[model samples]
Target: MAGGNGLLEVRIAVPAKDASRIARLLVEERLAACAQVVPGMTSTFRWDGEVTTAEEQLILAKTHRSRFEEILDRVGEAHPYETPEIIAVPIVEASAAYAAWLVDEVAAGERP
Candidate 1:
């Protein structure tokens, strides 16, 4: 279900090898309500003077949209990439119960 303005979209990039570990850490730390690891992503980009291609894992994190920057910062701190990609996209739909849980988990650190 749509979570109004409080809904967040958080994305992080990690090395294929460290994707799983970072995903677990983010969930355990409550930085993200949930994280989905997408595998076999091929990224080609210009680095230095030559084009480079690498296999990467894309992590989609669910959280309050307002907290997008915070989530990005956390991911950056934990990420192994010299320049990690952290992006957020608004969530359009989700299960009500799951959405509620996501809010609750994120509010864990806030004053009630």
Candidate 2:
């Protein structure tokens, strides 16, 4: 289900050092209304038949679904991982204030 604004909450994982950079870039570019970086997370998965564990920081971005592609492109440009974790989950419901703010933030960048 998608809301009127077609908003999405994007999640991406990166090294602790890069978390701030990624979050800042998305906000600075106005691709997201807000970005929250949570640290001290461990992820375990199998790669090439071998299980691996990683220490990662989680980046949560709020933006419209329309900007999902651009968000991925910007994040990839700075992500060190060959395959960075980029996922967007639709926002089925949101308060009117938040929805409006999100739409305005991602529609276009601010002019100086």
lDDT of 2 at 36: 98
Q: Against the true structure, whose lDDT is highest?
A: 2
lDDT (10s digit) by residue, model 1, range 3-111: 4647776777678998888888777877787889999898888878899898898988788865666667777788887788887777777788888898888777443
Q: Quote the positional error of residue 13 for candidate 2 in Å.
A: 0.8
Candidate 2 least-lDDT 10 residues: 1-10
* lDDT of candidates 1 onward, in order: 0.78, 0.89
Q: Look at candidate 1 and tell me the lDDT of residue 97.
A: 88
Candidate 2 lDDT over 1-112, as tens digits, reads: 2365588899999999899999999999998999999999999988889999999999999998778888888899999998899999888888888888888988877434
Top candidate (TM-score): 2
| Residue 39 of model 2, lDDT score | 97
Number of backbone collisions per candidate: 4, 0
Q: Estimated TM-score per prediction? A: 0.84, 0.91
